[model samples]
Target: MALTSHLETLKKKHRDMSEAIDVAQRAPGIDGLRLADMKKQKLRLKEEINRLSN
Candidate 1:
């Protein structure tokens, strides 16, 4: 049950990261570098989720 909840949280973070990237794209003033950092964080979260599932 804990694993299931963790997986769900990771999925939600992934979705939020995706939306953030999209928003960054649409905005001219936002720092692209910051968006890239968020994407990296999202990647790490996915990797952790995979490790936990295994």
Candidate 2:
């Protein structure tokens, strides 16, 4: 279904954001504000995924 595909895409984005967060944390010069924003987006995606799943 369309929802299934969308869910998959969101999950991928969420995972990518998680990895990005990790990489950013390890690096020295990354912007803290930007990283926080990404974390917020990732959390939003996770909420959306959960909403669609149930």
lDDT of 1 by residue, 5-44 (tens): 9899988988898888888878988887898898898899
| CA RMSD of all predictions | 1.2, 0.8
Alpha carbon deviation, residue 18, candidate 2 (Å): 0.6
User: What is the TM-score of candidate 1?
Assistant: 0.82
Best by lDDT: 2
What lDDT score goes with residue 53 in model 2? Answer: 93
Give me the displacement of residue 9 in model 2, in angstroms: 0.5
Off by over 4 Å in 2: none
lDDT of 2: 0.93
Q: Estimate each model's TM-score.
A: 0.82, 0.92
Q: Which prediction has the highest TM-score against the true structure?
A: 2
